[model samples]
Structures are given as structure tokens and as C-alpha cells.
Target: MPELLYWLDLFGVVVFAFSGALMAGRYQLDPFGVVVLSAVTAIGGGTIRDVILDTQVFWIKNPLYLYVILLTAILTIVLIRCPKRIPKRFLLIADAFGLALFAVLGTQKAMALGAPISVSIVMGTLTGVAGGMIRDVICNVIPLILRQEIYATAAILGGGLYVFFNYLGWSENFSIIFAILGALKLRLAAIYWQVSLPAFQIIEKNDV
Candidate 1:
């Protein structure tokens, strides 16, 4: 289980780093800026989760996380000769994958630490969306979590399903796989179909 979590964490880090680099490219940030954004977006949520859980931050304990982010950023720079222009859809897909992997891994970690199911669900959702939130804020855009899109909703649903499956005595591997796939499916659907939750609207006194 630990080995599976480790590899999944690495996968999430790489995908998240790629999304961050793509964002930096969109902003035409310098190489240093790109690296910083990539690192933050790759580990920001995990850092927060660890701090809140009173555990060692994952990247702080594992230098491989940093190395992965750096390499990912460098590769992005090399591949995208023109930083200012890239397909937005590619970034969205990558972000969805990262979100799915991180959500499952975070829930598993929280559960392993004996956190309550509710707390684990929140942690999972946070892990999935917090990094992207930070990245969007830094890039001067509205964070997806705050938008109408099915972003954090997917994470929360996936986390709930994971907990439910575990409670039903399912195997850890099966629960994890189902959770990740479920989250990814929902997120990708939202992305491709522009599915979104309804927004709140305030009516002015004059209109009323």
C-alpha cells in the first residue's frame, strides 16, 4: 500500500508540475518564475495537508519531489519554445489527472493516520484543489475551485466513495483505483462538456 501510494504521489507531482509549467508559460514568466510556480503547484496542497495533520511535509522528507518538479519545468521550457502560446485543453486534462491522483492519495494517507472519515474527505478534496488554487491565484485568474466547474465537487465525491468502499471492507487497491477513476471521469466530463454547477445571482433592489 505504501509503495502504491508513493508511486501515485510521484505521478501526481509530475502531472501537477506540468500543469504549473503550462500556466507559467501562459504568463510568459521567466525560467526562475516557472520553476517556483511549478514547485508550489506540485507540492502546495501536500504541504498544507501535512502541516494541518502535524506530520512531516512530503517534499521536505523526499528530495525526489523537488527533483521531479525541476525536471518537469525544464522539460516544459524546452518543449514549449513559445511560452506565451499553448493549448489550454492540454493543461486542463493534465490538471484533472493530477487532481484525481492527489485526491485518492490524500484520502488514503489521512485514513492511515487514523483521521475521521469526514476529515479524510476534506483533506482529500483540499489536496486535489489547493495546489491549483494557489497556481491560479498567482497567475491572476479565478481559481477553478471557486468557479462553477465541477472541480472540488469531483474530489469530494471521489473521497466519499473511497471511504465508503473501505467501510464496506473492500480491498485498498480496489478502493484507490475506483476513487481515482471516478474523480477523473467526472472532472474530464466537466472539462470536455463544460458542465458546471449553477451560480448564485443577486437581484438589485431596483430590479426587485
Candidate 2:
């Protein structure tokens, strides 16, 4: 289980790093900016999570994740010089995959720390969105989770499903896989359908 989580964590880092690099390229950022943004987008959430949980940061304990992010960013710069040519949906898909992986991984780690179920879910959602939020803010864009999209909801649902599956005595792999797919599918469906969450509207009474 530890080994499985380690590989998934690295994979998540790669996906997010690549996504960040692409974003930088779309904005015509320099190579250094690409690396900077990629690193933040790859590590921001985990950093916050570790600090909040009072644990050693994952990349600090094992610098291999940092190396992975650097390599992924370099590769994206080399192989995809023209990120503008790539469809926006490609980036969204990559973000969805990264979000799904992190959601489950975060919940698992929080649970391992003996966090309560609700706290675990909240941490999982934060793990999924915090990095993206930072990246978007750096680029002066509205964060997806802050928008009326189904971004955070996807992470919450994914984390909740993992918890539920575990309570069902399901296999470890089954729970993780199910949670990742559930989140990814929901996010992709929302993107493809241009679905927006329903907003509440209430009448305001004028006290004139």
C-alpha cells in the first residue's frame, strides 16, 4: 500500500507540473517562470497539508518528487513548445487526473494520521484544489474551485466515496481506484457539458 501510494503521488506531481508548465507556456512565460509555477502547482497543496497536519513535507523527506517536477516541466517545455496549439480541454483533463489522484491520496494520508472522517475529507479537498488555486492566482485568473464549477465538489465526493468504500470493508485498491475514477468522471463530464453549479437567488426587500 505504501509503495502504491508513493507511485501515485509521483504521478500526481508529474501531471500537475505538466499542467503548470502548459499554463506558463500559454501565457508565454520564460523557462524560469515555467519551473517556478510548475513547482508551486505541484507542491503547494501538499505543503499546506503537511504544515497543517504538523508533519514533514513529502518532498522534503524525499526530494525525488521535486526532481520529478523539474524533469516534467523541462520535458513539457521541450516537447510542447507551442502550448497554445493544444486544446484547452487537454489541460483540463490533466488537471482532473491530478485532482483525482491527490484527493484519494490526501484522504488516505489524513486517515493514516487518525484524522476524523470529515476532517480527512476537507483535507482531501484542499489537497486537490490548493495548488490549482495558487497557480491560477499567480496567473491572475479566477480559481476553478472559486468559480461556479463542480471542481471542489468532485474532490469532496471522491474523498467521501473512498471513506464509504473503506467502511464497506472493500479492498484497499478498490477503494482508491473507485474514488479516483469517480472524481475524474465527474470533472470531465462537467467540463464537456459546460455544466455550472446552480446558484441561489433570493429577493432583497428594500426598506425604503
Candidate 3:
């Protein structure tokens, strides 16, 4: 189970790092900046999760995470020579995949660490979205969750489902698969239908 989760984490990191590099390149950032953004976007959430959970930082313990992020950024720089807007579309898809993968991985990690179901769901949401949130802050834009993306909501729902299935005595493999699929479908549906959460608003004193 541990080994399988490790491999899955790698897959999620590569997708996220690629998407981050693509976003940084679109901003016309310098090569160093591109690498920085990619690293932050790929592992920042995991770092936060580890710190909050009092676990050794995952990427620090596994240098492969850093290696993958750097490799992705370098490859992106080499392949993207046209300097057009192509990265934007690719990044959207990659982001969806990253969100799904991270949500599942995070929930599993929390469960392994003996967190309660609710805490695990929060961890999942953070792990799924924090990287992108940091990426957006670095890029000087509002985070996707703060917008109408329904991004964190999808992660939370996926994590909740994983816990629910596990409580019902399902296999870990099946539970993880279900969680990933749930997150992926929810995110894609939101994107396809342009579904979004309503923005928070406050009534004016005079109106009230």
C-alpha cells in the first residue's frame, strides 16, 4: 500500500509540476522563476500538510519530488519554443488531474497517519489546492478556489467519499480509485458546464 501510494504521488507530482511550468512560461517568467514556481506548485501543499500533521516533510524525505519538478520545468522550457498561448489549455487539464490525484493521496496519507475522517478531508482539500493557491499568489492572481472553480469543494467531496467507503470495509485500492474518479468527474463537470459557486457578498448597512 505504501509503495503504491508513493508511485501515485510521483504521477501526481509530475502532472502538477508540468502544469506549473506551463503557467510560469506563459507569464514570460525567467528560467529560474519558472523553476521556482514549478517547485512551489508541485510540493508546497505537501510541505504544508506535513508541517500541520507533524510528519517529516514528504519532499524532503523523498528527493525524487524535487527532481521531478525540476525535470518537468526543464523539459517544458525545451519543448515550448513557439512562445504562444498553448500552455494555458494544457495546464487546465493538468490541473484537473493534479487536483484529483492529490485529493486521493492526501486522504490516504491522513488515514495512514490515524487522522479522523473530517481531518482527513481537510488535509485532502489542502493538499489538492494549496499548491495551486501558492502558484496563483506568486503569479499575482486570485486562487482558483477563491474564484468559482469549485476546486476545493471537489477535493473535499472526494476525500469524504474515500472515508465513507473505507468505513464500509472496502479495499484500500478501490477506495483510492473511487476518490480519484469522483474528484476528476466533479471538476470536469464544473468546467464543462461552467458551474461555479456563488461569490460571498455582504449587504450594505443602508439596504439592511
Which of the numbered candidates is closest to the native, going by highest lDDT?
1
Residue 157 lDDT in candidate 2: 88
What ranges in model 2 sit over 4 Å off? 82-84, 201-208
When 1 and 3 are scored with TM-score, the better candidate is 1
Please, what are the lDDT tens digits per residue for candidate 1 over residues 78-108?
A: 9888664667698889899999998888988
Clashing pairs in 1: none
lDDT, candidate 3, 1-208, per-residue tens: 7677778899889888988888887678899899999999989888899899999999878787898889889988888766654734577778888888998889889889999888988998899999988998888877777767678888888888888889899999888888889988999888778787886787778754
- TM-score (C-alpha) between model 3 and the true structure: 0.92
lDDT of 1: 0.90
lDDT of 2 at 155: 94
TM-score of 2: 0.93
| Preferred candidate (lDDT higher): 2 or 3 | 2
Cα lDDT tens digits, model 2, 1-208, are 7778888889999999988998898788888899999999999988898899999999999999988998999899888865537787777878888898998889988998999999999899899888888999999988887766689889998899999999999988889989989998998888888787897668998996
Cα displacement (Å) at residue 123, model 2? 0.5
Query: Candidate 3: where is the Cα deviation over 4 Å?
Result: 197-200, 205-208
